[model samples]
Target: MPKLWNETIAEHRRTVREATLETTAALVAEHGLASVTMSQIAKETGIGRATLYKYFPDVESILAAWHEGHVSAHLEHLTRIRDRAGTPGERLAAVLQAYADITHERPQHTEIAAVVHRGEHLAHAEQHLNALVRDLITDAAQAGDIRDDVAPAELASYCLHALGAAGSLPSKAAVHRLVAVTLAGLNLSPSTPDAAGGDD
Candidate 1:
């Protein structure tokens, strides 16, 4: 086939795949995940069942692909936040806050969230996220902004585990407060006199 023809075919396939993923997700959200079917997806996506099968073998596979795309987008977003101009501590705080916001604002597809997190892609994305935060923590500790008593990797884990509560918080303000408390725990500065009971 000609090069232009090949490129055009690839783009068309990409468009079809995107449409299928979006339609599948919407169906799964509106009707429960267990209640969705490949036939329904094909009808809603406006693609033939054979074409849908060419992209995904089953509904579970389609959902997995959708989840993977969601996670990749999130990781990319966090990477952009981390790369923005700022001191190491400032960048770290920004990343943490952005992560908490993601947790708070993520779609409330309980079943999908539970199933998706169990996938290997999530594990890899988590490792990538951990490394990003660990590098920032190392920078901050070297600058005396965060305590150096613990390893940066350990501190990164602590930050992630602490901020995970944002997913269940009642409001965005609660999520921000949680981020503040998590960051406070990482601070290296001495406690204020008032916080120390004023020279008791």
Candidate 2:
């Protein structure tokens, strides 16, 4: 009976966490990051304010949960792109493109991304992203696809900013414009453009 109670509690916690994330994302989509409230999310999730409080202490906590989900999804996509994408340059392009697509498709994620990025919590996530990007940058440099002189940390900062704001575009046409401009900073010399395409 004790084991069953524990299992039930665990499942309930999982449900609340998932529901909190969904509610936060929805509120972000409807009202933007600054407007979302823990009260609002509790109402949306059909749980009492006290129950919601038990699950997440504040609005930022909900946002943190939501951010965790987005980061996991983003990392999965990046890993797949890194492994299966063509060429080191193409991998970088694909990673950014995938990120751009996600922002456009999930405005809530974009909004939360913007809000979470306002402070040090996001800075930690940024460091993780930057390190991953640095690895890719090193590989690209080895293949002579990206400029060796540019530091990986610098490139990661630019890419993260771009990816975080990708939903700002008014239309698909703007995506190409933004991506083209961002890619231009990523080595893009005429000699490198024609390099054999394959990440392997």
Best by lDDT: 1
Question: What would you estimate as the lDDT of candidate 1?
Answer: 0.84
Predicted structure 2: lDDT? 0.71
* Candidate 2: residue 73 lDDT (0-100): 77
Question: What residue runs in model 1 are displaced by over 4 Å at the alpha carbon?
Answer: 1-7, 188-200
- For candidate 1, the TM-score is 0.87
How many clashes does the backbone of model 1 have? 0
Instruction: Give the count of colliding residue pairs in each prediction.
Output: 0, 2
By TM-score, the best candidate is 1
How does residue 138 of candidate 1 score in lDDT?
97
Q: Rate the local accuracy (lDDT) of all candidates.
A: 0.84, 0.71
TM-score between model 2 and native: 0.70
Least accurate 10 contiguous residues by lDDT in model 1: 191-200
